[model samples]
Target chain A: MNIILFEEKEISSTYHIQITDHRAKHIVKVLRSQVGDRVRVGVIDGGRGMAKIVAIKPKFPFSVDLDIQLETTLPEEKPVIDLVLALPRPIMLRRILSQVTSLGVGRIFLIDSQRVEKSFWQASLLQNEQYREHLLIGLEQAVATRLPEVSIYPKFKGFMDELLVKDLDDYSALIVADPAGTNTFSEALRQAGGSLRQGGRVLLCVGPEGGWVPAEVDQFSGCGFSICTIGERILKVDTAVIALHSRIMALREIL
Target chain B: MNIILFEEKEISSTYHIQITDHRAKHIVKVLRSQVGDRVRVGVIDGGRGMAKIVAIKPKFPFSVDLDIQLETTLPEEKPVIDLVLALPRPIMLRRILSQVTSLGVGRIFLIDSQRVEKSFWQASLLQNEQYREHLLIGLEQAVATRLPEVSIYPKFKGFMDELLVKDLDDYSALIVADPAGTNTFSEALRQAGGSLRQGGRVLLCVGPEGGWVPAEVDQFSGCGFSICTIGERILKVDTAVIALHSRIMALREIL
Candidate 1:
């Protein structure tokens, strides 16, 4: 873990907090931190700064006490991209959640597609906010505090017809990834008149393993979503997400 | 699997081949191919075309007979990029092999580094060409035939002082990834006067999980390797590989 993250409720006082969970074990066993040593720490959806280790048990049920000091500077830049993904298998979903979170996203929409297997929707990872742990793991990896909101839509029509229509104005551009797409991502952004630096938000839609059916592609096209291709090579769902996100982030940096 | 791959030695006569391996099982079970059905097929380091299923035994110990027809057209374009990676953990190495292969790389050099665990050098994945299976899986996913060459270097200095010096003239640019890098990837590329479309080969070097030590970074700098960063986020080793590769490929498309 790059940073130790704690929820707002975990703070016991103004400047002192004790952690006895995995973070404590990580600090003791992995980091091998000693008393008086300062380590990076962040409050979820809050500030980031250093925490001075005050006490350490370094034994079973390991615990660590820290004196927190958060920087008053501006918060980290919010992510400009959002994702609309067809629910993958539970195993892949778990990995994608952590990886994408590390890459940074404003929000995630796990929606249904015709090619998505019905059994995937029944996975426990999507139940009772079980997915939040994966997101938290991502935040730790990225050394950031903001947790991206995740919403699930089990019905493809509902997601496309209702939610998308309501959220259309929020994004400067809507993009759907397709292997057969004629336009590259940059070309699609140019064609749509979207500029990332101009406070424009991008909503990228990635389909299931089998890819979007022709009718589904037509639906996306009807909604002003530009079809874009990364390349001719077909990647797995998790790899595609990371690759696309990386490309977008790079374009943002260069453009 | 998007395409079934066959070794050159597996071809019988001139245009016929029989398969009773995992590929056959995938055809019978996952693809559910029937007699006379044509499926995409490719010969390793060879041409890609269609294979008509002539006969099939769908039961356990499944087998299939195919009549192969390779197109006379030229083979797929070779990858212009190569990778110099610090050995990661075994599981992550497996994923990286397949993911990087799918993304397209001409060669892979897995070398030791200061932060790389010593045990990683002994992984079976690095021995007996056992890693070829992951590469083939990647080829199947990408529907391409050319297999990238992989080499292992257990000693960091040997790789740097010997192999890299011999291969220095082959690449137009050499890049080393560092989180503290002052230049973005595109800036480094421009500084190196490298253009991907001009048949320029780029060699990308990625460090291990804990990152390269100062001495290693100095070694890279001494070799005319431009230091570049993807962004501020600290991604896992596997995620970083995919992200960096994706950014390079995207830049190739746009530039």
Candidate 2:
């Protein structure tokens, strides 16, 4: 972990915090930190700064509780990009969550697609505490305090009918990456760049492994989503998410 | 696998071939092909075509042998991007090999850097056949015939002094991604887009997880590499590689 994150309730009086969880073990063991050593630390979804280790007390046979003093923390800047992804396989989901969060996405929607495996919805990675673990790793790696909110959607049609379509009103652009798309992503962005509306936040949609089926593509197109291609080569969902989002971030000059 | 790849030696006659390995099992079990089913096939480092299953026989308890006819095939096109990367952890390297191969990199050089773990050079993933396995998976995913050539350099200073400097003669442009870089990747590409020279190939260098030390960055800078940044957010090595390469490909109209 690059930065240690703590919840607001965990902070003690006099700006000192005591940690007895994985975060404490990580600092004491993995970092091999000693008392009086200053390390990068951040409050969850709050501010980030350096923390001076004040005490290290053995809490269990192999774990320790750390007392640290927080100093000179600053509020985090908000993230710009948000992703609406077809829930990937559970293994891929874990990696994507950490990677995309490190890449600074503001939010993520793990919506269902026709091609998504039914069994994927039952995976434990969707659990809030479990999901939060991956995002914490991401935030620590990026040294950022803001946490990207993650929401899961298990029914494709229901999500589309109830929220996906309406959520388009909040974004400046709604893009779908499709292998069969006639226009390249850059071409689509160039056309949309001239007249972006709303909060300048782009809501990008990436499909599952086999990609969006014909009806799904048609539905997204009907919702005013610009269908675009990366190229003829087929990329795995995780790679495509980074590739597509990175290009958009580059073109927007946000990266 | 999107496409089944065959070595040149695997072709038995002008139009026929037999497969008894994992590919054959994939064709029989995963794809569930019958006598007349057509599947995409490609000759490694050669052409791509569709193969029709002519015959199938059980080779072992779980394996099968198949006779196939290649109807038509065309020569593969060349790839535009090549990479120079600091070898990541073995697990990450496996994902990167497949992802970049799927994304269509022409070549990859896994080189040493200040931040690279010395033990990484001894990883079994560096074995030729094991490495080729990952690349083959990538080519199969992308449905491409050609495999990217992977090279390893264990010594940083030696690699720079001997090969990296000399290799600069071959590429039209050499670009390195650094967070401290003055220009964004797009800005660098826009400048180079005006006058791309010799072979239209760009050699991209991406650092390790912690990134290049100042000395290493200075050496690369001295070699006429345009230092470019993706953004301020710290990206994992794999994410940065895809992000940087995708932007380059998009700007070049290759994606």
Candidate 3:
């Protein structure tokens, strides 16, 4: 983990906090931290800072208690990108959750689609605590404090017709990924008027393994979502998420 | 699999070929192909075409014999990007091989670096046939025929001092990824005089987990490698590779 993260409930006082979970064990065993060592630490959905190790007590099997002093607040930035993904297989969803969160997406909407397997909606990975766990893993890896909001939409039409239509104005642009799209992502951005770098929010929609159905594509187009392709290559969902996100982030910098 | 891949030796005659391997079983069971069914197929390091299932013999427990006609050819494209990566773990390497290959890299140099684990060089995953298996998987996924070349560099200094110095002129730009780099990738491309989109080859070097040491960074700088950062977030090696490749491909289209 790049930074040690603890929830608000874990803190006993303003400056002193006692950690007894896996994070404490990781600090003592994996990091080999000493009494006086200062390690990077962050509060869940709060701020990041250094934690000075004050006490290391090996009290239970496979566990330890660490007393640390929270030092300062980290410089934080607001998240600009949001993801609208068709629910993938449970295994791939878990990986995507961690990876995309680390890449700094502000929100995620795992919605159902014609190509998504019905069984995927029943997966326990979509549970609140489970999703939060994966998000925390990502936050720790990226050394970020803000937790991105994640929502599940088991019904496709309701999500698109009701929820999305209401929230469309929140984003500066809405883009959908399609292999046969005539516009490259760069051209899509240009057609949208300009880059998303000017503090504007973006909502990027990626399809399932089989890709968006013709009806779904038409629905997206009708809702004013620009269709763009990463290129000719058919990328797996996880890979495509990173590719599309990276491409946007890249263009936001130079365009 | 997007396209059924076969080694060059598997093509028996000018118009037809027979099969009785797992690929054949996959065609019969997973794909549910019968006589006269057409499946996309490609010859390794050759051309992509359609293979018609002329006959299906299910006499063996887990095998099927298929007679086919090779028809048509895929449009061939030249590779433009080359990768220089510090070898990741075996599991990650397997994914990297397929993923990077599908992204259309020309050559891959799995080189040792200061932060790279020595044991990584000893991984059986680096074995010729094993590596080729992953590459084939990538080609099958992307429906591409030509395979990218992979090379191993067990010794860091020697590869940098001997091979790299001698072959520096082959690529138009040499870029290295560093977290502390002042320039974003776009700025680096601008510094290199323009876009790599005009058929110019690019060599992208990504550091190991902990990143390149000062000495290694200095050596790269001495050899005219422009240093660029993806951003503030620390990305895992696999994520970084896709992100970097995606960024380059995106810029190639716009700039």
Q: How many backbone clashes does candidate 1 have?
A: 0
By lDDT, the best candidate is 1
* Per-residue alpha-carbon lDDT of candidate 3 for residues A62-165, written as tens digits (9 for 90 to 100): 34334545555543676778999999998988888888888999889989999999999888888655878888888888888888888788888978876565
Q: Where does candidate 2 clash, by residue pair?
A: none
How accurate locally, in lDDT, is each candidate? Answer: 0.88, 0.79, 0.80
Q: Model 3 misses residue A188 by how many Å?
A: 1.4
| Alpha carbon deviation, residue B67, candidate 1 (Å) | 1.0
**Residue A201's lDDT in candidate 1:** 86
- Better candidate number, 2 or 3, judged by lDDT: 3
By DockQ, the best candidate is 1
lDDT of 2 at B64: 35
Backbone clashes, each candidate: 0, 0, 0
Worst 10 residues of 3 chain B by lDDT: B66-75
Residue-by-residue lDDT tens digits, candidate 2, A1-255:
788888877777766777777777777777887777788887888777777777776445334334555554554666767898999988899989999988888879889998999999989888755888888888888888788988777987876886554676666677888988877666666666755432377778899988899899899898888888767888888889988887787666521
Instruction: State the lDDT of candidate 1 residue by residue for A96-122, as single tens digits.
Output: 999999999989999999999999999
All candidates: TM-score of chain A: 0.96, 0.89, 0.92
Q: For candidate 3, give the lDDT.
A: 0.80
